[model samples]
Target: MKIVSLRVNGAGQAFIARPGTTLLLALREQLGLTGAKRGCAQGACGSCTVLLDGQPVVSCLVPAVTVDGAEIATIEGLADGQVLSDVQQAFLDGFATQCGFCTPGMIMSAEALLDRNPDPTRDEVNEAISGNVCRCTGYEPIVSAVLDAAARRRSRAGEGAKL
Candidate 1:
């Protein structure tokens, strides 16, 4: 077993996992953060997406030991005191999810995109979330939600700058 220390959802956490354990397994099994689902463990599916140091990464492809001392963010961390982030709210408002199984990964990907590019074009949005596959809501609503979230974030930032 390998001891790993990571900051998850803004909380410091330490756990022991098998040497070859993936970050996804470590989070779900060791830390009890099951937000990142295990889909195609081969990294073909983005169901295991998470934010590593504010960047989107397929947790299934990351080794737990490699993530030592890294800050990770999952779907559970996207809300603030029960208030959803703009991206999450946009997903709900846009009805971007059907089964909701892929919602967390999609949201994580979109959040990463918006973080890097506050104002992204449709093509950019597509490129950012291309890794995530949603068989339920189609891709239109998901793209729409990301675009809406970006706009909302820009609007909020603008308002903050005015203050």
Candidate 2:
């Protein structure tokens, strides 16, 4: 067993990761953060998506020990108390979520995309979430949600800039 340490949702966390333990398993089983779903462990599905140092990656395929000291962000980190992040709020308002199975990963992907590109085109939004597979909501609303989130973020920045 290897002791892997990382920052999860802005909190410092450490756990003993047994051999071959994926980041997803560590997050779910060890840390008790089950927001990132366990879908295809093969990394083909984005159900276990998380942000590693601000980059979105499939947690199921990421070895826990390999990412020691990394900064990890999951869906749980997107909210401040009762206030939702712009991406999450956009998803809720845009009706982009269905079945809720893929919502966490989808939201994480959107967060990563918006973090990097405050203003993204529809094609960029599509490309950002291309890895995530959502069976319930066709990609239209999801794409719209991402774009809307970007706009909201930019608007917030604009307000901050004026201050």
Candidate 3:
């Protein structure tokens, strides 16, 4: 086993990984961060989505060795203490989550989208979350939640403009 170092959730973390260990396995099994689920081991499912170097990627498909010393952000990193991120709150308040198997990936993708475009349109939101597949909720609520999160982020930014 070799040690793989990473900046996960804005914190430094190192874990031992065997050859060919996927990031999803390291995060879930080694680090005990279960937010990113292991759906299809293949990249076809977005359930293992996480931000790698600020870009959304399927953690299940990424080898731990390849991402050594890289920055990673998972669903666990989206909250502050007991408070939730805008996307997470939007998901909960908007009832966008059902079954929640895909919620973490969906939220991570939405977070990445809003980080770049805080005022995205409905179509943009749809495109941002296109990689994520939700077996329940039919994606209407998910899209709406992403749009709502954009609005929330924009509103929060506008508050700073008043200062």
Candidate 4:
């Protein structure tokens, strides 16, 4: 086992990752952050998605040793103490989540897209979350939620602008 340090959820964290440990394994098993799920153990499924340096990446396919000192953001970092992020709120209020197996990765993709383009078109939203698979929701609600999140975030930003 070797110790590797990475920034997770804006905090510096260290964990022991066995040889060839995947980031998903370290996050879930070692860091106690289960937001990033382990699905295919390959890059095909986006269930293990996370924001690495503000870009969405399939955590299960990422070697823990390769991402040392990287900034990782998971679903756990989306909300404040009581206040949820615009995306999180949109997902909840829009009923975008069903079985929720893919919620975290979906949210991370939405978050990255919004960070770069606060107002993304439906096609953009679809493209952003295309990697995620949610058998329960059929993706209609998920797309709507991402668009709604963009609107909500813009409204919030406008409110801040006026203040």
Q: What is the lDDT of residue 111 in candidate 2?
A: 95
TM-score of each candidate? Answer: 0.98, 0.98, 0.97, 0.97
- In angstroms, give how far residue 118 of model 1 lies from its true place: 0.3
Per residue, candidate 1 scores C-alpha lDDT tens digits across 1-163 of 8788889999999988787899999989888889899889989889999999999999999988898899999999989988999999999999898998888999999999999999999999999999998887779999999999999999999999999
lDDT at position 120, candidate 3: 89
User: Which residue pairs collide in model 1, if any?
Assistant: none
Q: Give the clash total for candidate 3.
A: 0
Error of 2 at 152 (Å): 0.6
lDDT (CA) for every model shown?
Answer: 0.93, 0.94, 0.93, 0.93
Q: Which residue pairs does candidate 2 place in steric collision?
A: none
Worst 10-residue lDDT window, candidate 1: 129-138
After superposing candidate 3 on the true structure, give the runs of residues whose Cα lies further than 4 Å from its correct spot.
none
Write one digit per residue (lDDT tens) for candidate 3, span 1-163: 7899889999999999898899999999999999999889999879999999999999999988888889999999999999999999999999999999999999999999999998888899889989998999999999998998888888998999998
Strongest candidate by TM-score: 2
lDDT of 2 by residue, 36-126 (tens): 9988899887999999999999999999889899999999988999999999999999999989999999999999999889999999999
- lDDT for model 3 comes to 0.93
| Global lDDT of model 4 | 0.93
